[model samples]
Target chain A: MVQLSACLLRKIPGPPRIYKRLQTFRLNARYEGRSRNCYVVGQGYQLKSMQYTRVARKNKVLDFKELYNLRLEAAAEEHGIPFRYLWDGLRRMNILLNRKVLQDIAIYEPRTFAGFCELSKQHQVDQGLNLPPHSYPKIPVNTKGML
Target chain B: MHDRRRVLQWATFARSWWIFDANHQCPFQSANRLCLFLEGKHKPIYHPLSDCGDHVIVINTKHIAMPDRFWRAWRHFHHTQYAGGFQVQRAWQVHREDPTKILKKQIYSTLTGNLLRKGLMARLHLFPEEDVPEGMLRNVSNQIRQVMPVPKTLEDYPIEERESFPRVFEWPEEYVVKDGKEFERQKEYLDEDLSLSKLQ
Candidate 1:
């Protein structure tokens, strides 16, 4: 039970108890490959393992982004518009939305997403973008919505 | 008529930031996809006159794996007004100097018209590898995946499926193959040839 020093604790987030857990994971994530869990690893490799964890934490951002993009793309494909087009179409109609929200709408609120696409299709035809092979349902332009 | 319609469309357009991953993505395909964002071609309300396009922040540009031998065969040139200021670098060399240059250049060419190119390029942000500036990362709410599959490490694969991966054929015991020794021999040959070339 080697008690870690305060200087060693500098710049780490969470309580000391949580930091210990992170430190353990830092060593474990690397050492698990060789069947050496963090606790059994030697003392010298401690700080280095923590640094690896930091770098890996940053890299995890890319992982989340990759997931969000995949979901958005798949949902857009199902809606018969490439995700990019649908996103842009939404932008054109002043309906600002993010990939996560769009993905949720795609899965849970599909009719609403479709309605947004309908408006997007109307805008597309007005601007004359390259329409996909699938015929998009048009939003009926009415006198009431303009005001 | 066209200009008025463009203005009308722009009136209600609410812009946003988009992220694109260039890792292991083809430059041509990525450029085409990016062009839609730059030109606002993704929108039916897109037009030459209006700045209705959203911003794009691209990450993992350093890992762009060009197909075939573009690293050697491709060349980019630079020129200055001085009589002998012309310089050229191969794609590999360009990447070494600045990883984001090729991707930006590719995207720049994909976008149409000189008039809007500068403005459009202003909205395009690129980061080499995974390190993105806080400001660009802050604005990006969503991302677009590359059309093609991005290569992943062995650990990225699911543990359950790794063992279940199908094999096209299994080797017989008599047909055992040496691995590292053959690679070492080829590496030595290549090193010697490279050293000889350097001497020349």
Candidate 2:
């Protein structure tokens, strides 16, 4: 698993400590009666029920803001691409490639992502051009209509 | 000729570590310093000509844990390409189905882009359960090591303690509760609703 560097964490200002505490509290309360040990394998614990419950609940209730922010971070790590590139690509594509797919490509298929980046760059350049440049230097052009 | 002999010696050393003993649970980590001592990139004998590392046999693959916040937030995706398009699942789901895939992915990710990675990864054997492969467990005793458990970090604590944790069901959203007496009642109501709507 890629550990977020302290510098990166510092870059993204975290939510208030109290807000995080409350969120944690609610999550625990939601899974209070559920079986926590459903997936414990061997001496170590597997995917615990409480963890799943919390994620599901969080997704259902939380606003897209936090989720999107989380996805942004995920996209950066999973794609092995820089955060700025992902941000720029997302804006250029105008398509919301969810955090999950971006992360997968980051881990499994990187070359494909590089191709995506090149395409986005091309699209941006085309969109920027208002008129084609003349190959030859303009001979002292006279506007007859204006005259 | 000299390089071949060195490669053979390394392979032999790696194979020797496979035997299970009474005192060691994970002998590679404990007795042999498998994680530490198996010097692949650092050794002078190391040749990019061949895969010179020892084979790792991981007995249990399902039990590995990530640091705090990873289990909750990490999501993986697969593309279907048709109408439904992409499907998303978490890391936990992948781990549950095939635990060995996790180890294989990690190893593959770290290895240099070469033909040697295929040969090296082929040697890794990962089992979900405690059962060793037949004929391989020759007079070996199952001496489990007592792993020292670490305390959970602040982020690792139960979600109830966190403030930003969302509610189970948000208001105005229709959701049916499943798996309990309420679920049965809800199922009947849903059926009735469907039937009534069909009649209209």
Candidate 3:
């Protein structure tokens, strides 16, 4: 029995690291070929594609965060303050609501979202916050007085 | 019902004009209140991205009141973008230059910074005095309540009301009215001081 086990072990040849890598690449390429059309079967291409996939996943998360900001900005503007001021006031007041949650609230419970905006606006007023210079234009000239 | 709904929808989004009297009212407080209307926060259908704010006409900006000694203490800063171009003027000086500036600044400061700020600010009409232009006055359909009530002075009281007020006590027949003569003498001293200051 010991001689038979030794013969079986000797018969199994140890493959090189590149061959193992090539095998993984083939598996990955096959999966990719079945799922998607592109089949650039190679170790480097496999690694690069994996890296790109991770980057795309991260970018998707960032995109969603920005989308939430846009929605919140629109909602906050309705209540009279900008998204920046709303975020600032929220941070200062320690409201701790996340962007996703705030956007959801803005969509589902608009009145509640308005209250949040009003609270932030009130905080800004109380703190004596002012916008940047030239954020608004000067009152127009009215030589004609035809307003 | 569909037609009614359509009409109500139009009314909901319609921009209304508001008139506010700045006479004897604190500009800072009034601006805080006015900013709300300018942002459309007063409406249930207010959306920041939407141009739903109402127009506001502020009359009598010349008579706007400042709290305490802010007229002399408060300062407005300006820079001309040239070397040594820094300039700082007292609130009273700024007001002298432009009577509507203080209130305008207050309102401008209160508004959120965004793309719509200029458009929203343009909707605001400030008249230095009570003389709003005829064309603008015709657009006003509503009035904004003053933030603070104007205090009534002794002159505001009618002579009949003053005389009819119940007296707490009657003075004795022999009591001398010394204040009447002394008050007139004090007035003369005040007038002399005013003249002396003018001369200096």
Candidate 4:
């Protein structure tokens, strides 16, 4: 019965779990909570490990992405450009680097990161992506004569 | 590679000076925002172990506003670490004793209680009014935006702009409430007329 249940549990598509009844001998020596003490302990450990692995795996990616974005925002703001413009420009230019790599470059290789920022700024200007939001008038009263 | 790394180190850790105009801003709220700059939390490189905080110059502390009743109700406590040294004073009383003391105390309390607190406080320069010393003023490279907008009085508007403001309707010249004495007298007359009708 134990082997059949363990086999059925292993078929579920998730982190692999080890199933062994070696601790049953120790359970027999102690009369703690219930009759099937070893079985209960094994099930508890399996469930806890499965939940922990699932949550940790899911959140680790999100947490690192947030950290990278935060660093990128700070570095980009220092050069007087928004992070949105920098990310968009990088994509348009086919720089093809993930946020993690970009942030690493920002810290260790700031000069190169600054060059990336400048290139993005130029791209934004050329494509007119640097302009104010669509809600704003294309030409304001004060600057109407200049253009 | 070494030279580039050297320049990057200097650029990343270099301290910047920030100026904040505290006119019409609440002292407590202003302290909440100013503490970020004082502790370098505004920078992405902020770590509790790192001392990368920036210098902050706060001007017009004399004009800091407190919410209604806070001036009289809020009490600041201090202990001199001696017998009978415990003292308490209202926010306004402290402000009267020193115009900049309220803001200074607020910022001090908001900052984390750590060994670096004293060093971080040293970077903060507070002026009661707009008269910053020439040397300190020269170092300012950026301005922290004010938490609240300074309200504009009628006198602040130019006459041309005031006259050009569009209005849906204008008050009648003889509106009784427009003249305080006339309004009081009209109210009294109406009361007397009503009393007479009741008596009759």
Candidate 5:
């Protein structure tokens, strides 16, 4: 004959170490309660949420590309540098800076972007492009607008 | 050797400038929508602890709309620490005073409780109408329309000939409620008339 000892049963038992970690992994954290009733569904939900997050992570290329383009366009426009002219001239000179960098130079370091303007105009002239020439450093100087 | 995950990671941390057109848009919806961009919650790289939000330029704030009757009913209340400092102003009144305040406050409130909230709010540029500064307009490469239809201008209405058509209700030619006194007086009168009509 053998005797059995009584033991308390846990609703969803897991060691504290693993349980704490799973709790932290909740996607909609606000819905996580102390009851611990969601262990089964929680893991599945966490997985799905993570999967969506991965997709979102990968799609940022387009967003950044557009942002950089806008910044470059705006920065060039300020000094009366036509966007196409600046882009084309830079390409010709192999000054292949991304729009992200171009935008920074446009907003923060106007002087540097201005250099690009001079380069852009000079290149356009050398190439004999028919487009109306924009002056270098169109800054309150005499004979402005003549590249 | 382009890995999908690797490519996303590179883009995820980058930011962008967004445009929010508030013409005829519900303030709450637009503000919440802007919150996503401001907090970078829409990004795959969004971490609650990180600053991932993008810049947003809000235009046509002058035409932002609220549901019918909410303008009067929705009150923005405030108080000073002193006794009897409590005050409540209707939504329309506040909007009338400062066109950008309502949406700005909404978006600000929608941001999660984080240190980056203030910085994100700073990135939000609000303009009352289409007349944006040349500098700000230059950076805007795209536009995001609101979830609702654009408000039609008076010019969009069919010929003035249609103005004379009969309607279920019309504003009395002499109904002047520009002043609070006149408006209160009219409200009382309208209330009595409405009750009498109901009884009839």
Candidate 6:
């Protein structure tokens, strides 16, 4: 781990001074590759390709309606849980988490997403909340004053 | 006598009166009310065919109230194209540069969907500061008096109303109705006897 830390620092210079101070106190430091640059050795990661992949992932085409339906579908398909159980669990958790963030976690980090679902389930259990079958409301098409 | 009666009728018929103060917070509420009144929505005399509404003069627009977070959070968005092209500007930047322009833009947006919007907007007077020069005020006072009404809201009314509404223009009480320079000037304009050839 100490050798890994030296290699990482040598590859990406000029990290903030506060980060260097934190490194001294870190006993079991695990590097999370979320920063601007992450390096392993003299073989540096291609910065341009990393940025392109990030942008491409964001740009992946998904129909809005399909994406909305997928959330309930995926919960039932993967966990053998009903749509209501997952939804009520999410509501009970009271996380101000957006749908896009949940969708990203569900697609890329299934383990982390499963943990979130479990946390939400525990929250529902503690609150004694009952799940209701999900229903989509019909939205009125606003055509008034349209040119 | 008929003209005097008409003027009195106009004063009585005016449902709302607003006096904008430089010192007061939230002058836009008064501005919005004035815009609605000018749109002829408040008046019984309103006819769709003819444009008839009370004139509005917004005094001391420079000191208008702005929210504390307005400079950072408030952004006005505009698109250069029909699609994705856009630009954003902060409210404080617009205020610091030309506040009157910003006020006029807001007032115009509120007055939309009315045919008389342009005509009503033309009548709006925006003064940057409270102080009005005495000479200009005197010339314009008669016209101001024709439209000006008793103050209502503390938020809408001018700060000067607390001491008694100061007339923006007033004729000197000392001036007699003699054949003086002022009297002759008025007589020349009002002369029914004077022929067109004689005036020429």
Best by TM-score: 4
The RMSD of every model to the true structure, in order and in angstroms, is 27.8, 35.5, 15.4, 13.0, 18.0, 26.5
Query: Which candidate should be chosen as best, given DockQ against the real structure?
Result: 4
True contacts kept of each: 0.00, 0.00, 0.00, 0.24, 0.00, 0.00
DockQ for each model: 0.01, 0.01, 0.05, 0.21, 0.02, 0.01
Please provide, for model 1 over B75-179, each residue's C-alpha lDDT reduced to its tens digit, 9 standing for 90 to 100.
888879799777777786678789999999999888886788999999998889778888878888767757688778888999888879998987898997865
lDDT of 2: 0.46
Cα deviation at A63, candidate 4, in Å, is 9.9
Model 5 off-target regions past 4 Å? A1-147, B1-12, B151-154, B158-200
Q: lDDT scores for all predictions?
A: 0.73, 0.46, 0.76, 0.77, 0.71, 0.53
Runs off by more than 4 Å, candidate 4: A1-102, A105-147, B1-5, B81-85, B159-200
Write the residue-wise lDDT of candidate 4 on B1-200 in tens digits. Answer: 69987897798799999999999999989998898888876665755667889999999999999989897688888789999787777776678679999999989999989899999999999999999999999989999967777998788999999989999988798875543488567655755665422422
TM-score of each: 0.48, 0.32, 0.51, 0.54, 0.45, 0.34
Model 1: CA > 4 A from native: A1-79, A82-147, B1-11, B158-200
Per candidate, the number of residue pairs that clash is 1, 23, 2, 0, 2, 0
Q: On a 0 to 1 DockQ scale, where is model 3? A: 0.05
Q: Write the per-residue lDDT of candidate 5 for residues B1-200, one digit (tens) a residue.
A: 46986785565466677788898899998987788667765443445566777888998898888988887788787879799787777786678789998999888888877777789889999999978888887777655546677767756778765686677987799996554488767656755666422422
- Candidate 3 falls in which docking quality class? incorrect
Comparing 2 and 4 by DockQ, which wins? 4
Cα displacement (angstroms), candidate 6, residue B154, comes to 20
How accurate locally is residue B1 in candidate 6, as Cα lDDT from 0 to 100? 68
Tens digit of lDDT per residue, candidate 6, span B24-64? 34444555666645665443233445465555556667766
lDDT of 3 by residue, B110-173 (tens): 9998888999999999999888889888989988878888989778999999889899988899
Give lDDT tens digits, candidate 1, residues A32-136: 443345454534466676688899998988876666676566556545677777778778777778766776776557678777667776677666787766636
Worst 10 residues of 4 chain A by lDDT: A138-147
